[model samples]
Target: MSRELNNTLYQSKSEHNDQELAEHQETNKRLQRLGQEVLKLEAKAVNSLAERIGDNFSRACRHILSCTGRVIVTGMGKSGHIGSKIAATLASTGTPAFFVHPGEASHGDLGMITGADVVLALSNSGETHELNAILPRLRRLGVPLISLTGNPDSTLAREATVHIDIQVEKEACPLGLAPTSSTTASLAMGDALAIALLDARGFTAEDFARSHPGGRLGRRLLLHIEDVMQTGDKVPQVTPGTLLREALLEISHKGLGMTAVVDSTQQVLGIFTDGDLRRALDQGIDVHTTEIATVMTQAPQTAPPHLLAAEAAERMERHRINALLITAEDGRLIGALNMHDLLQAGVV
Candidate 1:
């Protein structure tokens, strides 16, 4: 190509690249500002919803507490989705509750509701036909009814034993057609109700963990060092004078990649890990004749049996180490654990 033509092409490409970069930056800034505005609106809506809380909320809580059966949450459309989540949260937080789709309730699901149960219904307009249809049956069964709706005078709210208003001043949707602020308000109110009930019922972390046994919450709250740590003969241990070769045998036998070097009182003086072995080998140290204490790390990291396995994992991560010795209050080693153990126990 000619030099002049090549120079012109390069200039055009540079200008195009600059324009594209400018447009990208402007688009990102616009999106960020719009996101912030939406968050502010939602925050304001939640705050307004909180201000509207009154005696009706208290009455609803009392009714729920007094019920001898599960709290049946029923709703339609978007409200139904939110109601299901609320029911799940309530159930996990010590209040027994479950969602019953209002539409399904007419088709034999109504039998799921008993006289001892309390009904918590949701409808943004407070005039959902499906919900209103079941009101008569709920009333006939003598079940207490609590309604969450945007309209105070709607049929569902009027029929409710206690009505908690969830009206929002404006919808976050620019078109004002979609359920936005109203749904957010309802969800926040449901969370408030579930948490209040949880507090009233004295729901503890252990109770919460029991309901979430397969997740990180269960690991952090329910798993202790004693539950996952290697105890007794499984703990690789050697006295101060023990040769590094024998300690290596213990490490291999236990499959923990390390051995604890202890004194006469069984108090851990140092730890010799695979990493230390490599370093010693690099330094031309004789493993067969060397005493483990001579090459061991003094005052190694130790955790108590009562410590959470999650915390132990954190400790190992923070130190960039893979194993920890379980020690008593006076620093005597009682147990041991490794990264693999945490992984196997589902605590990592």
Candidate 2:
């Protein structure tokens, strides 16, 4: 409790805290180094695949491309996980494919495979018994078998119509027991195959959108201005002879912050927006006395209802506008949409 004793105890605590901090910093450095090493190893494994893309890769792609039925991907354990993702990528990219469990295939799921189909089997060692069990049936069915394996001499590779060697120099795991680098290599190869098939088949963004209709990309690519535009009475509009106050009322009722100044024939003459109202007010123009035509912007930018909503969003951003009028080919106002509608539809 004396001053000297208290000072000595404080010094000891400070030294201990410094030691803990130093240890924490050293541990962080070790962790960062380990992560970097794993990334480098996996990247190298994937890069090595570039050299393996030869006759066998082309053969595998050709077999899948020629198949009348879907590509049935089958594997076990980590390979199975990779196979499933590969199948999904293939299916979404214009090569119809799906994953089937190897163990389940032996238990009657093998019926899924047909003569018209192509089999893509994944196994690091090329000796997965479950995968091999169905090979004879696949062969009997006269289906093309594409095998991806580390060992070209293994049974699956030998039986395959086309073999792609996915061997990695070493696993990212320091113990070299886990399937880290090997699985990464397999995934990379699968992606390469899917992209090649996509390119060969002339798969387009619209086709991709069709497969992913629930995604943001699908909405942006597939949704049209007519699909999200405010139609009928929902669109704000006013005649050129209408008072600014009446146009403001229409704008407020529609909640679009703007209204089209249309002629009696429903042709858009101009557009009056909240910005226009502000400018008019700044110039001391009376809303009740002013005609909307005098304050409206003539020949305002308009889009066709058939235009992609994504394209509309881009146009709005480029022009620094928040709303657009949808017009018919004959220049009549058909509908209207604001940025909020695009946001709600997930096009922006």
Candidate 3:
């Protein structure tokens, strides 16, 4: 469902908005206090983390970077949930990583372990039984282990080659049992580690786009005119000296509302659009005998075939044109893209 539809699904639309407004006022006070608490705790956690980054964090990064196999991140409960997202972020950002559920690790899933891998364990107390249970076997197999916890002196942290402290003062939850600030701090630390590796590897936006090829940003970054433009026989074009009426026929046949006027070498000369036709009719121009170049817009905006489809879309919008001719570096017409092409490709 759309975000708007999903939001409306649970919201009360009755005339009791005044009562809801009063409740919102109370909630705002609690939220304002909670937001400040979270910020303060996060600042403290990150500051401590900077001190802990000295020697162990560097060793951890080197271990993860040199691993022949994937980085296995594991935690329990709320930490497990955050670890899953952290693993995904790391993997998509160029680090080969995946989450192994701690509970499942104690089961036959332990077979997924390998000697060439690095294990990253997360626990606020640094004593999660399920995670610590399999650490012995990983060590036996010579797998490097890194632990992130609030208690750096705990058993799991002591056993790890590196330990990252993610201690927080209090939970946002009224009851301290809930994992609130700690989980946020842990997730942020994971992001910092993943992004550090991303920068170390020189991972570019285009590389990230390849990992998210189905999303809009991916399309904007990865898609070229060659992917979205009409090419070969689909392009509607006429020689520069062709009759305006002939060019109009091609435009009508192609149904792109425009035609490219090109030379014998296919170098784009100009463009004749529906807007041009309207102006021509107002000027009482003779379409039958008049050359297309006489009425076409001179040096109409052209984009390189390798240009991003999103950029081509922007160019069309900037020039107030509905279509763009795709040319090579030498101005040879190779393709054509209309607004509809961009829309269909989600470049708009």
What does each candidate score in C-alpha RMSD?
4.5, 0.9, 8.5
What is candidate 1's TM-score against the reference?
0.80
> What does the lDDT read for residue 156 in candidate 2?
93
- Residue lDDT tens for model 2, 86-161: 9999999999999999999989899888889999999999999999888879888999999999999999999999
TM-scores for every candidate against the unseen true structure: 0.80, 0.98, 0.86
Which candidate number would show the highest TM-score if scored against the true structure? 2
Model 2 CA lDDT for position 188: 96
Query: For candidate 3, lDDT tens digit of each residue in 116-153?
Result: 89999999999888888888788888988888898878
lDDT of each: 0.93, 0.95, 0.87
lDDT: which is higher, 1 or 3? 1
RMSD of model 2 against the true structure: 0.9
**Which candidate number maximizes lDDT?**
2
Q: What local lDDT score does residue 10 receive in model 3, on the 0 to 100 scale?
A: 50
Candidate number with the higher lDDT (2 or 3): 2
Task: Please provide, for model 1 over 1-348, each residue's C-alpha lDDT reduced to its tens digit, 9 standing for 90 to 100.
Answer: 999999999999999999999999999999988788777877898999877788998999999988899999999999999999999999999999999999999999999999999999999999999999989899899999999999999999999999999988888877788888888888999999999999998899989998999988897889999999999999999998999889889999999999999889988899999999999999999989999889999988999999999999999999999999999999899999999999998886
* Candidate 3 deviant stretches above 4 angstroms: 1-28, 31-44, 328-331
C-alpha displacement of 34 in model 2, angstroms? 0.7
Ranking by TM-score: 2, 3, 1
**Cand. 1 Cα-lDDT:** 0.93
